[model samples]
Every structure is written in structure tokens, then in C-alpha cells.
Target: MPELPEVEVVRRGLDAHVTGRTITAVEVLNLRAVRRHEPGPADFAGRLAGRSVVAASRRGKYLWLELDGAEAIIAHLGMSGQMLVQPEGVADEKHLRVRVRFADGGPELRFVDQRTFGGLALADMVEAAGAAVPAPVAHIARDPMDPAFDPDAAVTALRRKRTGVKRALLDQTLVSGVGNIYADESLWRTKLHWARPTEKLTRAQAGELLSAATEVMTEALAAGGTSFDALYVNVNGQSGYFERSLAVYGQEGKPCRRCGAEIRRDPFMNRSSYSCPRCQPMPRNPHV
Candidate 1:
């Protein structure tokens, strides 16, 4: 699952290469690729042909290509999904699910997904958080990197949650863009245990946690996002270098960079959470 930073990197690439280009043709190689486009593959292809992409936009982990009309094409880049821009004569990728040719006949946009969990959908533009977003993304909260993101409102939303602090942070409605990896990193930076109760946190502590999340994500974006494997890559098929900069996310049994305490991993929501026991002391009444 690509997080906000990874998705943002893709969006930036699309903005640079795909925007302003008119779709000359669309080939849906797999029906599952446009499963969300309800009207079937023919209608999906018909609607996209000849339409120009006005902009490439994103909210949280959702990426979309705003078309000439009020509709946008939303891309769901599930675990192994990728949106690549390749030269016209390049060999098609083995897992290529959708091939989009432009009027310019230069490079083509390809949607390749090995796991087939991702898909494309045409959605009507709807107002969300004062911006025009695809209807499917209307309910999602603005991410920390969004220019209109309100940190104070986000802090209030975090404290309002009765769940553990990390769980609250992972809630997209509370604060978008913080996933499991970044959530642990943010908690570690704030010196807060994953199981700490959100309501127990002071306003200052909540603000600091949000700030840490923003800072870490900003750094991750600069490093092209953390890629642990080949599944996650940019439009040019380049992996991010941020994995080498991670502190406590997957550093189980490793020495903490700050306090020199051994890092530990705990089972969390069918996944894992890593932290330093000494720095982030467990709350007496842990929510977990």
C-alpha cells in the first residue's frame, strides 16, 4: 500500500507528463482494471477518448486526472499498482492493465498492477474541503501537506477520538496521510506510546505529534517516499531512498537512534508497530 508521500510522488510525475494531453485512445487490457467505472469497459473507453487532462490532482493517497469536463479519472494504486509513462515503442509491461495513448503520439501512460487490487474509475467532480475532488474522495479529510489543512482542527479531531493515539492518527477522517509506517515514526518522534489514549493527550502534545508527522512526511516526500520493494516506484519506475532513513518503523531489536534503547515490535491491527520501550513508556491503562 503506497502512502501519501508515494502517492504524491506519482501525482507530481503525472502533473508533469500527463496533464494537458488529450487521450487519443484507451485500451482496457483487463476488466478488473476499470471495475469501478460501473458503465463497463466500452463506456469507460468512450468517455475518456478525446478528452484532455486538465490537471493531475490528489487527496491523501487518492490520485486523479481532472478531465476537460467536470469528471475526473481516479486511480486506485493498490499494493502493487503503478502508473508509468513509457515511450511509444517500448515493450508493454507484463502486468500492464490499461494503456492510454495521447494525441501527441509521444509517450503513453500505462497502468500496471501485478496484484490486480488497483483500478481506474471515472468520477464526477465534487467539492471537498473547499477544493474540487473526485466524488469518491469527497469524504476524505485533507492531508497534512494540503495547503488548506488546518492543524488546529486536526488536533481537535485527534483528541476527540476515544481510541489509542496511533489509531486516531491512522484515522483518515481525523488526519489524512499518516499510515502504519509513518504513524509509528510520528509516535516515536513525539515520544508517545502507540497505546497512549488520545483523550489523555494535552493539546500541546497533540499539536507536537501532528507537527512531527508533517515534518517526517515532508522529509519522506523529499526522498521520493520510502520504498521497501519494487512494488512501489515513481512514474519513471524509480524506487524511493527514504527506507534507509527510517528510525523505528521496522527496526525491531535495534538500538534507538535517540535514547540508545532497544527497539521493539508489537502486533497491531493485523500488522506491526515498532517503538522504543524506554522513550515511549507504555501507559498504565493502554487502550490496546
Candidate 2:
């Protein structure tokens, strides 16, 4: 899934290319991927025409296209979705879901998703993605990138939970913008075990962990986010370089970067969690 950095990158790219341009047309190749408005192809196209994108912004992974009135077009990339700005004559990719042509001769904004789990919606509901708890974005407890974010706030949020540090960090409502990759990397950087329970952590430990998370995520954003699978790409269609900088996210069974012990991958729900046993040892006394 595209996290905050990737979503921010996409929003910035689209803002430069599509903002202020009038929507001349909308082509929906897959109707099932759309929601809230336009039950079919014709209706979808009809609803998008003549509207201009007054501005573009992102809250977590959801991208917002502000139009006239209180209406806005909302999009979520899910796992495999990406927004691309292609030249006028460029051929559309096979995964194209929808394309918007602008009246200002700017490049077309295309939504492409290989898994087709992504969706689009038209709504006057202006709630940011993080406002809804448990839907990925809302799970984040705190984000260091936020100007108002304090390391102490992050510690306080985790202090109330008994969940494992990894699990708590993965909760989007606790912090916005962090995904699996960054979570593992941040935990590793702090030399904290994934199995460490939140309630067991001291305030100083929690502060250190939060600071590491922020630093790791900021570094990833600067590098354009990690691209392990074919899922993530910049708006310009270039790959993110952060994957090479990963210390523990996907290096299971390999030697730890900080310690000689082999990295481990523990199964967690649908996905797996990676860490270095030597660097992130399980707490000697497990939380009872």
C-alpha cells in the first residue's frame, strides 16, 4: 500500500500537472473500482466533465481533488494502485482504471491498479482518510512528520496499550502514515523487539522508539518510499530507491546489519514481520 510519503509524492506530482485545469473528460475503464457515485461507465463520465480541480491534497493514503462547490473526488491506491501523469500521446498502461484529460494541454492523470482493489469516489464528505479508525490511515497513532507531532505524544499513546510494539505501531489510528516497511525499519533502528509489549516500555524507551520511527520515515520519504513489490512507483513512473536502504523489513534469514544473528520473519495475520533476533531481542520478562 502507498503510505504517506508515496501519497504525498503523488499529490505533489498531480498538483503540478492537473491543478487549476478544467476536466475535459473522464474515461472509466473499470466501473467496479469506483464508488459513491456513478454506477456505470456513462454515469461516471458524465459526473466528471466540466469540473475543475481547484486543488489537490492528501490525508494519509487518500488523495483529494477539490472541485467546485463542496464536492471532491477521493481516491485510495489500496495495494497496487498508482497515479501517473503521462504525455498526451503516450499509450495507457494495461492497468488503467480511469484517466482525466485537462483543458490546459497538461498531461493526463491516470489511475492504474493491477490488483483492482483500489477505488474512487465522489463526495461532499471532506473527512481525511485518517479520520476513520482501523482503515489503515486512521490506525496510525502519531506521525513525526506532522508539525504538531511531539515525541512525547507518541509515547503517551502507546503507554495505554498492552499490544506488542510492532502491532501498536502498525495501528494507523495511533500514528498516521507508517506502513509495514517503515514500522519494521523504525523498530530495528531503535533496537526494540517486535514482541515487546507497549505497557512494558518506559517513557524514555517509548520516546526513543518514537524518535527513531520519525527519523526512519523521514529518510524514506526523502528517498521516495520503499518499493519491494511491483506495487509502488513515483508519479513519473520511476521506482523508489528506499528499498535498498531497508535494514530489516525483507532481509529474513540474512545476517543482521547491526548484529551477526540472522534476521527472522514472523507470520502476522496476512503478512509477515521481519526483525533481527540479535539486535531486537524479545524482552527477558514477557508481559503478563
Q: Show how many residue pairs clash in every candidate, following the order shown.
A: 0, 14
Clashing pairs in 1: none
Q: TM-score of model 2 relative to the true fold?
A: 0.87
In the range 1-288, model 1's lDDT, one tens digit per residue, is: 588999999999999999999999999999999999999999998999999999999888889999988999999888788999999989999999999999999899999999998899999998876789899888889999999999999999999999999999999888888889899999999999999999899999999999999999999999999887689889999999998999998899999999999999999889999999999999999999
For each candidate, what is the lDDT?
A: 0.93, 0.77
Q: Where does candidate 2 stray beyond 4 Å?
A: 36-44, 125-142, 284-288
Q: What's every prediction's RMSD, in angstroms?
A: 1.3, 3.4
lDDT of 2 by residue, 126-151 (tens): 34543422222333344567666667
Q: Which stretches of candidate 1 lie over 4 Å from their true place?
A: none
Poorest stretch of ten by lDDT in candidate 1: 126-135
Model 2 is weakest, by summed lDDT over 10 consecutive residues, at 131-140
Winning model by lDDT: 1
